[model samples]
Target: MTASPSKLAILTFAYVSLCVQFIFTVGFNHQVHHSNFRPSPTIRLRATTQVRYIQIRPGAQFKIALFADLHFGEAASTEWGPLQDENSIKVMNTVLDDETPDFVIYLGDVITANNIPIANASLYWDQAISPTRNRGIPWASVFGNHDDAPFQWPMEWFSPPGIPEVHCPATSSAHSGEEECSFKGTGRLELIRNEIKHNVLSFSGNGPRDLWPSVSNYVLQISSSHDPRSPVAYLYFLDSGGGTYPEVISSAQVEWFQKKSQEINPNSSVPEVIFWHIPSKAYKKVAPKFLIHKPCVGSINKESVAVQEAETGIMKLLVKRPSVKAIFVGHNHGLDWCCPYKKLWLCFARHTGYGGYGNWSRGARILEITGQPFTFRSWIRMEDGDVHSEVVFS
Candidate 1:
């Protein structure tokens, strides 16, 4: 069937417009921030990869607020009642207003997929990050096991046959009642990567592309002085991977860390604070575990994650790094503690979201780093504005 001349002209114009829009989007993918509003300086890694890194040098002391287990999609009990989503934004702005941290790290489990349909997922994620964006504080993230779980859910007549696939490989191992994973609904990574592209507010990695199809793994150097080359501490955000990859960290990631650590701190010990969603088996070894917030101080009252069958080698590599000082994780909502283990400290962040399954009071783990003598101190910022677990790194 041949189209009329007018129809043909309209089709041609539409095609051209679509092409131009795509070109513009790709061109501006690395340019979410507008000119004249420079935030942090971007630096290249010591490794051969082309990943972008952020150098944070907030003068004498830098405060980092860690929010974990913020499951944003859980619905409220009453129909059309106040959504549990409100809790996440509340915690974010409340903490930001109180502490004014230089950087905020979301320790994963940003959303709960089972309660949220696959299509409206991005809205939850965008809303969840409102506080950071509104305040203009630079932030980063690591995905919890639940972030992308909606993708694994079963598809229930996902789309009309002629609609074409909105999300590629529409289903994951995470099946339950035929609802397929789609960025509009199930793909957590899609929403997060778009945010990461902003660069102005988020330092979420564009890295370890070799690891999995996830955006959460990378090493960011916090410079000591003005020069990005002179780094003081490194922040390693690792993807624990069970949702998209594996529950355990891979040897390749370990090797990448070794390369990056040596590259950044080639000589003296430049400390590093690790952040991830799930904790390793080693976290269980930390002494005096807790089910709630405790007054932990220097090797006391540290909580451990429940034991899980995990692969090895990443922890060994971490221990070998003279610069690596403490590891911070968030998965189990009830446990919040920090303790010394094997010359390094293993810490647990409190569950800071209302949407998750825990009844524990919501709060964030706050880290205050000082550059002068290279000291690290952390405590919990509770929902009621009370701080707990003030521990200086031993």
Candidate 2:
């Protein structure tokens, strides 16, 4: 039977709409069920990949590489041209060869999307950290808010018992009854845990559950393997969920942090470093004077306000703790460093995978920490090789 032109057009539109919905549904479902729930690819690459070396003063201080916000899938191209995975791999390989540090720490936002496909995130992590893992150097990572929610609960397909199951709103609308609504206990959390266990040096975070200790954050401490009594460095990996969307750190996390801080140093000698996805309140005070009160230029809404009140609270906590040295963060996606409070530096690293408005270059920071003082060196990848930014920190 032949249909009229009007009927045909209606059918076509309906078909297109259904197809679009189907794609979105599949993508979303894939993210919830599979994201962070599998083992990364086992690709065997050459061990000779070389990275540029930047010599630090004294030459004896321990080096710690800080890589944040890779945002792998955010790029337009599947294979990020020279600067991304390729350049990153080469640089990491070289760094591992040159500076055999005790271990490495990734500051979060390993995956690009808030709801990334499990395969994409897994593949990205596999490629990104394969070099480090292959070398046997332990690396640790914290969860960025983007690495959480709206995807799946208890993302624990790879590792069991690490994540606990929690009830979240069911994603499937068509399913009937409570059984259809609830997700399998050990799916999403396992994936993230396994990724961290296999790829990271150490792993700690509240998976699938409402951000543990805090709402969505955790703290990590690194010490000298040789001398436990010797003052080493500490990292407070705070989860500033997403952006300034008005969220508060849970009371439990705050209490935990306070207890941990007290235990770290009764006298407080060990230097501490805080890593958060979003810059804290102290960051704005310390933000380059030019960035402060400056309107969000270009397409970004000027009145949105960059810093949030919760940041201030976070800063207050840090300020109270004399051991904290600096707060490292991403999300703003620019090069800006500030020292608002006494003896505290708010450092922002450039994004490695994605670029900001009009800023297309890919870069990251390598931080070196000794007993009391620390240093940071920035690197950018150009056409020939990676270029070192002249700015050095002490």
Candidate 3:
């Protein structure tokens, strides 16, 4: 009953075709299911149209601006919060007008709410980012805990057309059933279909991945477009999420950061800076008892422990990695600076938007770094485009 050779060959071919078809069907189904649950798009910033290359001659200097904790909708009707936004925008535009930097790094919390309307979120993004766009300066950002609150949709929803949408699982309950939340709308997830355009770096997930964990941590590595001889600088933007109140750096981010440290050139003699929403360590030394909350106040011990553990874990990581020289942060509404660890400067810039406790000194920080014994100088903005506090770092 053996089959003929020709018949046997045909039967084998048919079996192989059926297996291929089955595999294709299974893969397609998996992709379809994943998309249905998380439909966010990826958005990337575009390069500045007027990119001017400047060579970093010996004794050359470069400037960068850092601002965070905008909390746009914090006091929607109050003149204080909205006025802060207006003042911040004016100060940023003035900085661009005064001293043009290679680029700017906006530490996150661009929007205040976890569940704010997409239109309102888009308006804030547009208003806050318009200064840079109009100046043709590029900027990068990391998420703040407030930025990742269950209410605010992914930042990519606001990206203009032609950029890919950034996607993440609906891990939080606030945005559970939504297919995708973006800064830009009109229903399509693909960036190519949108008309909005701006340059920024945003990723999926509520916070930074474990590999580079600090807060809502990320790396912004940039080289002088004009100077081939300029030493490259790496800006490690961390995501502290909110404040020490409820820390947000997860265990996953810590593991990711350790691996990432190995990639940095410890011996290259180049300067690296770290930025985060919350300061890694407080500027003033408070008593250990102050760090602990009283149970009589109905405070949960576990919550306090989590904050201490998360902060300590990140500090341990920073101490082990010397390439991280300076850390910039803003959470406290006032300006302060401290040296948390040897060779590591922790600088807390004042909040540009929304004053706290009647501290009406609304301002932004402008940082200038140079090679050959790296240094930095911070400038603060005051009323009517007046900037002061030009403190130099050695």
User: lDDT score, residue 29, model 3?
Assistant: 12
The reply for model 3, stretches above 4 Å from the true place, is 1-60, 77-84, 114-120, 150-216, 224-230, 243-246, 266-268, 282-309, 338-340, 355-357, 384-388
lDDT of 3 by residue, 1-394 (tens): 2222212110001110111111111101111121112111112222332111222323457666666666654444335556666666776666666656545666666656443334234445556665655444445665555543434233433335423234423547344222333322211111111112323212212233233333334454444434443435666655564522255555566666665555554463556677766555433332123333321111111211112224547667775665667667665554433333455655665466552333445556778776555566666654356665455554
For candidate 1, write residues 181-299 as lDDT tens digits. 32333565676676666444566865656766445778776766466556567788887765545677767677777787676567637788888778888876654644433333431
Over 1-394, each residue of candidate 2 has an lDDT whose tens digit, in order, gives: 2222211110001110111111111101111132222221111211232111112223255556666665443342323431454555665555555545544656556654433323234545555566555554445565454544333322432225433233223456454443443332222255356664444234445432444423335444443434333335666666565422233444445555676677655566767777766665555554443443322111111122254336334556777877777676766655533343565656665554442232445445556665434444333322224545323333
Q: How many residue pairs clash (N, CA or C atoms closer than 3 angstroms) in each of the candidate models, in the order given?
A: 13, 22, 37
| Global lDDT of model 2 | 0.45
Q: How accurate is candidate 3 locally (lDDT)?
A: 0.46
Leading candidate by lDDT: 1
How close is every model to the real structure, measured as TM-score? 0.75, 0.60, 0.60
> What are the runs in model 2 whose C-alpha is more than 4 Å off?
1-59, 75-101, 118-120, 149-188, 203-221, 224-226, 243-251, 289-309, 338-340, 354-358, 372-394
